[model samples]
Target chain A: MSDSPSARASRTTGTVRIVGAGLLGASIGHALRRQDVDVVLADVSPSQLRLAIDYGAGRDARDDDRPGLVVVAVPPDVTADVVQAELEAHPEAVVTDVASVKLEPFTELRRRGVDLTRYIGSHPLAGRERGGAISARADLFIGRPWVVCRDEETRAADLAVVEALALDLGAMPLEMTPQEHDRSVALTSHVPQVVASLLAARLASAEPGSLSLAGQGVRDTTRIAASAPELWVQILSANAGPVVEVLDALASDLREVSDALREPDAPGARRTIADAIRQGNEGVSLLPGKHGQNRRFEQLIVMVDDTPGQLGRLFGELGELGVNVEDLRLEHSPGAQFGLADISVAPDALRGAVEGLEARGWRIAGNTND
Target chain B: MSDSPSARASRTTGTVRIVGAGLLGASIGHALRRQDVDVVLADVSPSQLRLAIDYGAGRDARDDDRPGLVVVAVPPDVTADVVQAELEAHPEAVVTDVASVKLEPFTELRRRGVDLTRYIGSHPLAGRERGGAISARADLFIGRPWVVCRDEETRAADLAVVEALALDLGAMPLEMTPQEHDRSVALTSHVPQVVASLLAARLASAEPGSLSLAGQGVRDTTRIAASAPELWVQILSANAGPVVEVLDALASDLREVSDALREPDAPGARRTIADAIRQGNEGVSLLPGKHGQNRRFEQLIVMVDDTPGQLGRLFGELGELGVNVEDLRLEHSPGAQFGLADISVAPDALRGAVEGLEARGWRIAGNTND
Candidate 1:
């Protein structure tokens, strides 16, 4: 949640031009327009431009209009070309691109001997399963990381303008070099997607009965594997170097695990298996907890009947007791008539929340603190 | 959510003797005792047996007691030995072990020339992160799959006894041969665990800034990597053959993807990458939905404020509207005060639920059906 539009004066000025009226472009248009900033939409496809305009994203760009900012939000394959074109077309304006991968296009432009002073490469780590102008939302970037890749050649004013754009869209602006941005996302996003996809691919040929015994582990691990291949191919190809590095390391680790399992009783084999899993424990612990804290939330699993209002009653009761649910997950089995609602709360609030719910006649199936 | 204790007459008859007194053993004891069945508990550790008894899991084993059914619930490493000992100690009793792997122990027994006519191997696909009697719950097996490995040599009466145990403890019993059980779990459970761990292990050396950019994708893929190494080493080693098979295939797939990314412009490189991801899409679709259906429930994303009562009010309103939420996932950002609650419901209920929530002043951020 953020403040209403125009809660503060806009740091961005003048008419903003957005090329490629797809999800990112249309979303930026919508957010900027919500703040009553002038936005001009442009797309190679007339129908896409019309659709984005009809969605109230922005007005059509006019030939004579002089814009102060240009945003290239096209596919990764065409991002560098469009960014270069936009920079040439609006030489006086600050230009930026919101592609998923930052370094590829940045390097491409540098290789082309293009002027880099007016252009900044950035990526907002925000998206939905579906894409297009039709799926655009004004708040898509709220509270999400928007990485800004800047270099010594980038002017302070141009950098400020890009950061201001991120802030205007409710995104947290994080500065990272092009190399750093590429490496960070390779570890965090790109490799995870590849691993998830490969793992899920294994399941396509799995027997149905074997799949019937699927629990939360397989479901969570492979959920992202359902992403669009067309979109991922472009993104993966763009960040190939870093992505391959991680994938290669992962494959090596997997082989070690396989080898260790194959001869678990052999000297040092069990130790290899144990170390891999133990390393995972240490690695997962490094992740920041929800709410940007290092501590993990205490989880309470409460049983809820499948009937319509059971969860409502439980949450309603929790509300009455002044207990905030920081996060919630509903676990349901294939044949179960009831589900388990795993409610997470701050550590200090766990006891009170559990006691309150229990007193309200809710069964506290289990809790982490217990 | 199952029938209250003794709502129906249990098919399981006679006293049940449970060995090991760990999570599974203690949990079985608790469930049987709740059904008014006499239970005798044993463990190699006296403190563990005392703890289970003090927790009301069961009574201590007596010298003269005769058990009609004996459940060996020790660690996977000693499962065969314990099952063999239980069968020898209770010659008249139907014996079963709850080790994760089936074929290894069964083969071990067969190699020892032990009679297994009274022995059944079953594994309940249920567990918590923490183990031991302190983490045990009577309803651990409710609605979960309990795989029973049976052979032609096993008597029908003995097979029925094991199935009855599963049913009485609120599990669905699925019969399979030891080989089938091993292969099934190797694909579904064991392989996922190894993959998750190996992937998460890559994060150990990653920079904290990179980790700070982590999203739901990484979190879900690596969630199970936190499981105990001591337990997993035994399970993976016992199911090594099948586990290694899947791991080997997965590693091969990863190498192909890496090679493709290394030369994405080479003929068929892009195709290979696309095909891997496309296969993943197909594979993920094979998984059953939460309600045991092939159909996916439509999802609606609603923005909920950080306040204590916002989610409670939202669920309460949905309850009043008679729209049952099939599954719920909360998406929160590190810096955001509010989170997005993605609620899944029946496809037909989408329109009405959206209209109702909109009229109730709830902002529906997005929906899948759109």
Candidate 2:
């Protein structure tokens, strides 16, 4: 959907072979085919390979086909074996594996005594809750980070080929070592998954009445807990070292807070609890906003009736006022006749947007700008 | 805006006095005043009281005024003292305090050996990130759970008055004991706040590059960590017993997962991690949906260009097709020029909505109905 002419022109040259026709593999094939590059699809599961091809991702591999580049997209558990097999089969081509954990596969390949010069480990930060070719989209990787784990021993030409693949798929290529890449994801992705799951697990024995009182807080914190356990088990095991580090730190912090709550009047108990939250405030502020900067957008909550076209009318009026909503969340409790459409706009645009909406008979429930 | 004649007729009769003209207090006053009930506002801060009155929340308290109900909405630390004072000052009035923690104030008043027949502890599960009379809204409690703690010694008439107050504000009144209410909120609210804050505090020392790779998971998990530490410390401490119970349980799960990750190849390690996530799945499923039922809605992610009117056009088309969106979330990456408006509708409406949008020249990126 985001294909650009400049991006299409710089697409990887020559025929490309993809092993493991899953979501990532098929998505790559689709994006590459849009650029008019030749693609060959292969997978251990004949049904999966056939489905990917039927979906127009690519064509089946032929005996005479000589690929210039091979991409491996498979689960982390079998990623190294697939990458090694592809490398041995295509000595003339650069090989890249898009496994979530870069270090494990790279280390496994090196331990197997495979030559690493032609291999580049990569991971694209894009996915859906569901998996397989059915969930594949040509623009899945667009504007997302595609980390390339490169070493000094790698040839520039080989590195360029993998980077070109990322670019052709509309992903921004970022260079990092295998260790750095694993550690980065450990903090940003893996640990959050574990924490969310652990928090949600506590609710298994909770009373339904307790859960009936659940608000946006617990909902936000546990939304990702609905992820498939089979997939996460592999991910957590593959990146165990880094994930363990972050989990241990979180456990220690949790212990201190729990102990303080157990004896709130004890010396420094309140300070300990307060400091944990204060540090949290500092940590969350470090995350980049929509424009990839440390800018804080002003927010307005406009009440909308829970009827068809009410949101359409509100947003339509917002458009007429020339206000661009940077972020939006629609919140409505059960049994309520109206919903609150919380929207964020640039700080400079907050006053005018609020004034225009109020003038247009919209009820401003709340605003951060006030 | 939802001031139905039926709701207005059932409003608490005579004058209603509100102590501590903060967010909750002023919001209660606004909603009650909308029902044509007289409200008198009082606060320690003269400016706050003046501002709340000027905002049409209520009028200045007079010596000649005799209130039939008094609502005490003060900070948790001073809630007990203020409630005791208000009860002593208004012997004939049925007094209710809208403090977050019910057990503390009720216990303190009982410790003072004061008559508890007129006092009913209540909490409306409504708040904004910002506070004060300036943030007050008449419909703040609409369709929200309003927990009222009543004992056997309470008279039916007094309880009826409190229930009427809840109904007049458009809240669903729920009856619970002081202990039960505290425990329920601890499981649903207090512990989640601490867990979120502790998880977010880990990001304070993370590399900026690592933060750049942040995605929807981490963003949702830590969103509530931005809450004010001063307020959270009081909440955590006031309900420390129940909060500690939950936190300890969470810590045990975290330790088990951490240890398993530390030795992923050990026997039963994978099963341990998988079990935690599976239990999370079961736990999150217990929460109700937007329809006040356990119904699962189908989701559709429609891509919208990041322009002023793109969202309006999309929703307008959806309205024309007669689709009622149950919930919506807008997602966009930093450098992406487009955003994805993920909307959930009734499962029965999914096919028609998707087909209608596709026919209208809209790009339907993904849908759960597939």
Candidate 3:
């Protein structure tokens, strides 16, 4: 989980004026500061602004310099106006806004006759459900993906500056068109949050005392529901249309599943259930792989008893084997036997992990290739 | 995480017949075997039958001894047929099941005119996604929930016996009607799996290059998608209507969110998105506080830098505080500064945990009681 600091600083051709002293703003400032680049941090709330300053994200605006770059990190609704205002105050600063959805802000800026040659859009894929400058950290962007979007009019130099900033913050630059970014996130991120919340919402209406028995599956699936409301609104509103498309497809699948269950004994009923499962299977396969597919991990399924010390011993064995576990997932179906732990190890090391477990007389299911 | 075992052996009224020597069957046999109670294990697969014996879930069929209890732990599609056979073969034995969905098996047995006095629909809220006797665990149900549905024909003594069995297995007994159990699980369990898989399937089609940047959120959200397909089909089919209903509602919310994003400035769009987040917040509240609503400890949300060694120090301070953590959930969100950690402690020890963090100048959020 540790990412080394960026040893070589890319000399910035422009200074980025980061307005908004919240998590994103502070992080941007922190990243720039670490690279020893000049940055001016501004915020409406004096307390928040002071916090950013105290945290060393940036110094005061009167730092004897005009910013060549401006990154606006604020709420979704206020983002565009902030960008234009920053642009109006400094006509030369190549400006970009860090917001979840791009199309709306891009249109708003274009409508106001902003300098398209200097402007671009970006959103760094690094955050917690928690918010505020209080939650800001310097390495927030380390090894994270920061998405950058540019249209035809944008200057190549401006794009490079943004890319440099992303790299300076320890984030990998991901290039995509505005529409592509919005749609992909709609399927990948936005829709999933809504689904998680809706699913968790049902627990409130569950018959009395039913939830007390809830296990890890419900806990994991509903984890995102605890996310802050204002933040989600910013995300859901920005990518609403694309998200709706995915939901509509899911609705169609659900309807068919419903009809199929009503008459399970009817002709083709078995196929109906099977089809729903297959559709779900197909749908889940579209997600990005681990570290955006840079790491290929094999799923090692080990059947573990419900006894104490079993998991510890199994993990100890793996540790002894020196199997570098990339990830671990536990499945607790509703009333079966031992839990199956699907561990992700380096693709090449999986055979060893499995062989080690097998030699220790552990019953393994499925090959690592699975 | 440890619970004391039952100090005294449970006095069994008679032998228990467990049909289907797969994971669940073998588990129940192991649990009861530890209690020194008689159990008979049966299954369609001779290999599975042998594994159950090898695992010591039960003795051979000749030891059936006219069981006083019969448990069905097979496929959902065949539950009713097998339960009917068990009922016909041993009319004196009380019947129960450890299947995912209850209504189907209950109705199936009733439709076949099986005796109701000895029949009580029960579902143990413990499991692994894996199947087969090789995966069986004796204490699978320990400290979990065991839901039992009782009818007028269900003998009070038999219900008590089942409850006693649940307690002996270290599970808390919960009461539910057949319909409620089916509907609740359909929403909370089966639908989430489908939804998670549906989400994961989308990742499979992701540009291999783009997929590399995938992070923990995507991985956690899509975790359940890796579950076995056939088992889920049986579960979804058995509780189709309610599962479909939940999915339908989710789809509606998804459509609304999507439409809002397409034209975010449109009337009522922002409120719609906000409502979805608020609904999710409320849903999160309904989940059992730490430890299935039995908060054995207090919760402390610590705000830490995104830098390395920060978290290790935070945990080290907790260890120095002389308080052990029960569980932890970490996230790397998209577009945020710092990660907020919610750590739980006993109610009385809450202040100490807070003091320990604050003494070290860690900004902590949220109170256990509040």
Query: How high is the TM-score of chain A in each model?
Result: 0.98, 0.98, 0.86
lDDT for position B164 in model 1: 97
How far out, in Å, is residue A138 in model 2? Answer: 0.7
Q: How accurate is candidate 2 locally (lDDT)?
A: 0.88
Query: lDDT score, residue B152, model 3?
Result: 74
Residue-level lDDT of model 1, residues A1-370, one tens digit each, is 4543346677788999999999899999999998888999999999989999999999987888898899999999999999999889998999999999999999899899999899999999999998989989888888889999889998998899999999998888999988888888898889989999988899887865888888889989999999999999999999999999999999999999888877888999999999999998988888777767776788999989998888889998989988899888888767878888989898899999989988878878788876
- Chain B TM, per prediction: 0.98, 0.97, 0.85
Better of 2 and 3 by DockQ: 2
Classify candidate 1 by CAPRI docking class.
medium
Question: Compared with the true structure, what per-residue lDDT tens digits does model 3 show for residues B175-208?
Answer: 8888888777876678777777766656665554
CA lDDT, candidate 3, residue B58: 88
Instruction: Return the TM-score for each candidate structure.
Output: 0.99, 0.98, 0.84
Between candidates 2 and 3, the lDDT winner: 2
Best by lDDT: 1
Q: Give the number of the best model, judged by DockQ.
A: 1
Per-prediction DockQ comes to 0.80, 0.77, 0.30
Sort order, DockQ high to low:
1, 2, 3
Question: Lowest summed-lDDT stretch of 10 residues in model 3 chain A?
Answer: A330-339
Number of backbone collisions per candidate, in order?
0, 0, 40
Candidate 2: list runs displaced more than 4 Å: A1-7, B1-7
